[model samples]
Target chain A: MSMLEKLQPIFREIFDDESIIITKQTTANDIEDWDSLTHINLIVAIEKHFNIKFALGELQSLQNVGEMLALIEEKVKKNE
Target chain B: MNEYKLKDMIVGLTQSFSVDITNEMMDLFLRLSGDNNPLHIQREFAKGMGFSDRVVYGMLTSSFYSTLAGVYLPGKYCLLTGIDVSFHKPVYVGDRLTITGEIEFISESTGQVEMKARILNQKNEKVSKSKIKFSLLE
Candidate 1:
């Protein structure tokens, strides 16, 4: 799958919104159910899927789908 | 993104700690925040208003979520990037609080980590609920 394709699943699972179609521009305001409580769950799910962990700093900086996709590529390269 | 070798920073990470809201602590919260809101500082005001005693600051309890997110979860994580919070109910002075954190998502792609979090006061009342969005590094 392409980078964006891989990312949409993670977003969908975290927000518990299967209909969630994450675009590069998608943000917190775009998702009706997105909130602090579920945010942590999203983090955990992402970590498990990538078989990697994110530093707190990186976790905080993520702003949108595009940013996350960039970081994921970086982390995958680091793992390789 | 701040990355630590888990073991090194475990001592202070996600310290899933809790404290009973003692009368003294309530006083401290009141004094520190200068939130002498009659509903929280005066017994008469509290009782007449239908509360047992002066209540504690909603933030005091919500802060536990901070400890859980900024500290634990990923373990040896970076400082929190941003946080969003909500106060649901009144937190009385003598309430017992319980807070917890568990990792559900760690995205290697965006360096974004998300967790499920909440805080509840003694009466099993949910005092605050929030979804925190933190980024890597500073």
Candidate 2:
């Protein structure tokens, strides 16, 4: 499955919203519940699901879901 | 009670404490929470429900988790961020509960520590388990 397809469920579970449809341009501003606390929870959940650990500052610059997907893809590739 | 700085905490570090559940504790909990459920407040009701006596409030039993965080594991620097807990068995008044916690994960970048903890009664049966997370304020 594609990265977004895999990430969709994680988003749904974290936000407790099954209707979330994420796109390349989907930013935190687009989600009402995407605050600092949930951001941390999202990062932790994403890291666990992808089996990748993000170093400090690696996620600080991400502006949208597409960037996050790109980062995960790169890390997963590196792991392989 | 012991105070631990952020630098002092390591993965696998563990702390254990014992708490004696008493009538005063139950009275205090009732005063504070006003949770007067018959199972918790009435011995006859609890006995009819098959428990040996009045059941202790689950929250009261779990409240010691705060002591575990604030006084033991990471100690005075702890700022609890979250807790995920499960009640596996019932706890009753007059039980001696031993609470133990161990650091499972430490994030130096965020100054956060996650601990796996459990409470066991005098009978050595686990009554509750928790995953507690806190930020260490340096």
Best by TM-score: 2
Put down candidate 2 lDDT per residue, B1-138, tens digits, no spaces. Answer: 688987888889999999999999999999999899999999999999899999999999899999999999888888898899999999987899999999987655445678999999999999999999888777
lDDT tens per residue, model 1, B1-138: 124432332222343446677788767777778878887778888888787776667777776776666555444455465567878887876678877554444444344544556777666777776666544552
**Candidate number with greatest DockQ:** 2
Worst 10 residues of 2 chain B by lDDT: B105-114
- The candidate scoring highest on lDDT is 2
lDDT of each: 0.65, 0.89
Worst 10 residues of 1 chain B by lDDT: B5-14
Name the docking class for model 1.
incorrect
**TM-score for model 2?**
0.92
